[model samples]
Target chain A: MPTKINIRIVTGVILLTVQVLMVIYARFDEARYFCWAPHDSQNEYAIFATVNDQTLTPDQIQKRYRIKQKGIDPRAIQHIKDIIERYETTYGKDSPAEVIMHYSTNGIEKPSWRWPKT
Target chain B: MSVNPLKIVNNEMEPQLLLTAKAVVLGLICGKYFFKLSDHFLPVWPIFDYLGPPHVFEAVLKVLFIFGCAGILFNCRVRLCCIILGLVFLITPLSSMVSYRNAKVFTGFLLFMIGLHKKGEVPWLVQAQVIILYLGAGINKLFEPDWQTGQYFEHWMHNIIKNPYYINATMLLPPMMLSKIMCWLTIAVEFIFPITLWRRFHVSFFLWTGVLFHGMALILSGDDFGVFSIAVLCSYFSFVKWPELIRVSFNGDNLLHRIAKGIVNVFGFDNHFVWQEQAGGPLVATINSQTHTGTLAFKKMVLYLPIFYLAVAVLISLAPTAALKSKCALLLYVLIFPLPEVIGYLKRKREKA
Candidate 1:
């Protein structure tokens, strides 16, 4: 009986600790997985990209990101930034793609992000 | 006679509640997986690049997820199925940052806990996980400047949702004040729920509040969170100590009663209700020595009947408009269903006076 009680207590503690830690981590991390803060931000964003001296259309931008080119992303604006950065640094590396994203977070418009860091 | 929330225990175990929870959670996951399979025929997501060039590991995981869901639903090695499903949810999010949703992770954690649960034991871990979820959500929102200042709600309602009701309200009341009120109400409720849910007396109140809160969210957002609200509501069954027997007596001669009986026979897998003919006034249901008549009795019947509850949830989720959904939910879940009981109580009080 004591062993069972201890096991239960340990399990409970481990489960709760992990959840609490994830919640804390969410504040620092851009990808808020395991965090309960859903819809905390309404990121209205537009993505622009130029690959090999050719400007990509909205359809191309959507295809690249697997998200709509211009729409409200109900997460942190950083999520969009990360996706753009990952794609540019990865499969599109050799192509010399220049990407820019202008976004507003919760009615407050922030500066645009340019790929390759200016 | 008042219905005691606790003390409704069977000698074996409350398999009904557990099974219902499993079905709802797994069913929602299955639906999500179906969409994922259709959307990405091959694992073109960045996370799949690590396993192999061909995406064989991702393919196997998807197949396993399907089998896991089927196993759980068919009652074949439920514990093993839960573990497999839990692992799939845990690993799937790692494939891409975009796929990571708080609801998915929470669902995975829940399945893991469910898998570990022993029969006839109080589900302390499952209950704790729920409390932690609400508490984390509340605390996070409390600290977020956008949430505290009502900016998030303002932007969400005006731009993202384009909710007509909110827009109409903005005409009469100050938009900031209205948004602030909504923001604080949500924060308070989320915080209060975690504290209250642990108590037997408070569980039912918080559960009802949670249903209304999440129901309103689904209406306004239109499945943006994707079964998060439904999963949370279904998880509330974990807290309830469901009655072993629900005796529903109705007139067998009546066509309506016969139809109701037929529905129960078809859907009530656990045989929670004991059907009998009492050719009299309204349909009466006796649960835990407490008798309910009229619409209240019908409400109780539906509450215990998991299939009916799930059907109602799906219908609410599928409603096209926020206005229509809110009106229907308020009428069925809140007003009309309980109005008869309130009137009865008032009449009895007047008679005694």
Candidate 2:
């Protein structure tokens, strides 16, 4: 017969283990977002991929991102901004900083056109 | 001296106890397939990319085919039905692998155990599968960095309370603390799941905690994970001493007690006659009660009656609109099925507390 004490102890340990695993999973593992991108974005679909990439419409981006959007870590947003700035500086192409700024402030907006052909 | 036919027939019911097991296993399998059909093919809302040319026509056809085959087997021999039920264990994991291996593996174990009910033996294969599942999930979670630091829980909670359904003013507390608490709580629950199953710790706390934790996840995220959590609680069935509750139930007020006891006894019951109680006597009694009688009867009825009646009701309700054929029926099935039980469970718990 299973004693209540035994159940309690087992429960405690298992609870701890799950909590720990969840934290580790959230931090280290790549977040799984169900969204659309230009097929090369490693299956990630941010609400605005680099803000002004005309090929990726805001509607498409928002649709993909909106499907599974959760709370974004404040620090994670900074990380995104840092990566974009670095990429723009390295490429030396007149960067879409203003577009990036627009998305960062306004969130994603819907586009008037249909989804890009998959 | 003449032997009473009733007495002889009563004697025969003992050997036929396994029939009950066959019925339950068959019932659950049919229930699941029926449920899937409604959810996948005839949903009220078009799932994701539904209107775009049926993306999973093959998968949909396979389910229909299996549902048809299972229906035939259910009407045939019990022993043969059970063997075929056992074979279903193979198909679940294979199909799951085509989707996501992790989900498949987890689902496979649940299916395997539920299938084991056909013979009334808690096979070693099932026990091992359960242990491996919990251990594997626990280990994987342990190694993840976000999980280790507790940020996952923190992130989850901050967004969780913001969902319109779960919004509460009390959630204005610091996210860091919530995150840490959630992180530890998940690990602690997973680590001890197997231990509690093995009798190293009491399982009720773990099971109840899991219900709360997972319940929170479901409510906040609108995820169906709460169903899986409830199924996991069934794993601790061996440890649940359900008889105490029934015994206590009968102890209050003489008039009520007699009425309850008389009803059970009149039905020619063993321990299995009482809901949620384990049989204390006879191999047949234990197996039969769990499978053929009492709570098992309720379970079987819950699975079969809902699908059968709802199918008829749907057909009638949708007769005017032949185009809606199964779609309208499916909506009614999903919406109405859990109402009584969900309300009952909550009411019972409230009364007890």
Candidate 3:
């Protein structure tokens, strides 16, 4: 007979197994069902790229940069550079990613100042 | 030469010590990823939809694997398990690149609890959780005057329950009384929860009161805090002899068994109750069955999924937090004896009443 400790061991195993299976299932489920958006026939992974120059906000800038790293858009590289240049003016040349992250998260309205025309 | 080999051997094979370590790692992994998954999947905040479906799915899988590993470690020898578990857990926060520092702090808290363990100590880990949460809650409330005054949280809860967008059928409860009871109880519970840990009251009384308080919250707030509270309650009984749950489960089964058997037969629900004709009408059926299924329907379900599924999600969300809190609270109560403790004084009033 397994001890109480043994039961906990079993519980742990069950929890981990369930989590792993759920992840696998959820991944397949998303890919199968909700991957596509109405805007595109192909599933467009979310990212912020070149926003037509005239339209720029810190929020969009930050969000685009995030998606850029996830391999969403290569074009976002220049825009990210532009945003970094603006941010570094006040935040210093070596303003870390943490500052950018913090600003993006806490600031209710991203610096864009206007709504994006979808 | 007097050799200390025996002492060294004794030090090495400490079973309880190993369990303490296991509990800490298990608790950390469970806390970190479970909450992370919830945040991604059924996010409390609507705005942060950044994780997207694929990343959310990945997170869920990570949580499952972490939980699986903890279970595997449980059956193994304690010392070896602890070493491996501890290392994995310590590395986890780093691996996850947790942006929210609360997750890291929560992990540290569990590790601290593990470090403080003495041989045959009451499961301090569980108790410490409650105390930390109570204090955290108290501090949070202190920051928000409306919560302390029973305005903001009460109004928020009232609106949430009264939301017509969610529950159209209202006869399940008397809304006015339920609302009042919920508001009053929440305020009272938050206020007195700290005092419940004081030594004056019998531990059983505190436990029972807590169970009732959370039970009310479960029913009233759609099982908001119920899950966590239940988990916390379980930690108290860790010292119970083996297979205690099985014994307790079957203990009063003669009457329950008969009633359950009778109900099962009467309802003809041996398998799941499959409706021949849509149980509620086409519209109802559409809402309950067709339009909403799986996580895609989770948002719709959250807004409206009868009562059971809503309760299940609420319970699931609260489960880990509650258990974590209870263990934490108990740990602190024993370790730190409050000076000029008013908690003892508060206990006598309840007993006399």
Candidate 4:
């Protein structure tokens, strides 16, 4: 019984600690895992990708990111950026692909992002 | 028997509430996966590109999740089921970032907490986890300038949801003022919920309020939030004071009585209700020593029965209109309390004709 009680207590503490840490981490991070901050931002973004001098269509962009080419991302715009970065630096590394994303957060237009930065 | 509110409130360790909570949480999780089975089987994100057909791994996890849910639902190897479901949810996000919902991770942690405890033990940790979720969300929103200033709410209403009611309200009042009022009210509720939920006196009040709050959120946002509202609402069962046993006596073995018995036998897995036939007596249900007759007794039975409660929840979730969904409690009240009596009356009239 004592061992069982101890296990419960330890599990409780660890879970609580991780949740708190995630909440704190959300302040600095955009992905916001376990933070419970839903619909925090309305990131209206459009992603344009050019590969071998041919611009990728909306369907192609959606296929690449597994998200719509242009839509409102409820999380931070940074998440969309991260996805693009991860894809570009990974399987698409061999291909000469340039990506640019124009995004607005909370109805306020922000600076556009360009991959393979100038 | 007389009902003792104090006794019910004081007995915080009722195992039935925990069981019901498990049923609800797992039920919602299963519904989500079942509805979107295809999405889970596919590895949509670039992160899984190097994993060489990550779909195979995802398929295995999803299969395990379904199996775990079945085990939990059937009340067989529940602890193991919780652990498996928890691990599946925890690891699912690794395959694809799109799968990483806060509610899913929260559910994972909650299941893990439940699994760590012994059977029939008070899920104090589960309760605490819910409290922490509210506290974390409230604090996060409290500090967020956009949430505080109504910018986020305005963006959500004007651009995202484009709620006609909000637009109409803006005609009479300034958009910022109306938005700020709604935002601050939400912030206040979320911020105060943690404190209120801790107090025994305030638990019921906040629980109902939380339901309404989440219900409204679901209505306003539609399904954009997925099962987050359902998950949180189900977790509120952790704080509920469930009756240990219900004693019901019927006048005689009529059609209604037989149907009631059938329901009790099928849905009452825990044997919470004990039904007795009493010749030439009024139909009555005794719970916590409190006796209720007529529609009230029927309502009490339905409310206490886990399957019925879950059915009502599923029905409410499927209600067509936002208005109907938002007024879930009232709808439930009508359905359970008076609608059955109305149906019985119609049936009797038809039989007479």
Q: Locate the minimum summed-lDDT window of 10 residues in model 4 chain B.
A: B1-10
Model 3 clashing-pair count:
33
Q: Please give, for residues A2-96, the per-residue lDDT of candidate 3 as tens digits.
A: 54554433443453344334334433332111111110111112233333344435565444332232222111122333334433343333532
Q: Candidate 3 - CAPRI tier? A: incorrect
lDDT of 1: 0.70
First chain TM-score for all predictions? 0.79, 0.28, 0.27, 0.84
Q: Is candidate 2 or candidate 4 better by lDDT?
A: 4
Report how far residue B112 has shifted in candidate 1, in Å.
Answer: 2.4
Question: Given candidate 4, what's the lDDT at residue A42?
Answer: 84
Judged by DockQ relative to the true structure, which candidate is superior, 1 or 3? 1
Worst 10 residues of 2 chain B by lDDT: B4-13
lDDT of 3 by residue, B1-353 (tens): 11211111123332333333333334444444444432232222333345456465456545554643454233333334333333333334332322212333333333333333433545444354444444444433343333334443334443433444223323355544443444455555654765666433565455556655554444434433312333343333322221101100111224533343344334321122222222222211123233422222222222221122222223344354444344344432332223223454577688999
Every model: Cα RMSD to truth: 5.4, 14.7, 19.7, 8.1
Q: Which stretches of model 3 miss by more than 4 angstroms?
A: A1-118, B1-68, B71-74, B78-119, B158-184, B198-200, B221-233, B238-353
Per-residue error at B257 for model 1, in Å? 5.9
True contacts kept of each: 0.66, 0.00, 0.00, 0.57
Least lDDT summed over 10 consecutive residues: which range in candidate 1 chain B? B1-10
- If the candidates were sorted by their TM-score against the true structure, best first, what order would they fall in? 1, 4, 2, 3
* lDDT per residue (tens digit) for residues B54-108 in model 2: 4464355445436433532343333333334433433332322112112222333
DockQ of 4: 0.53
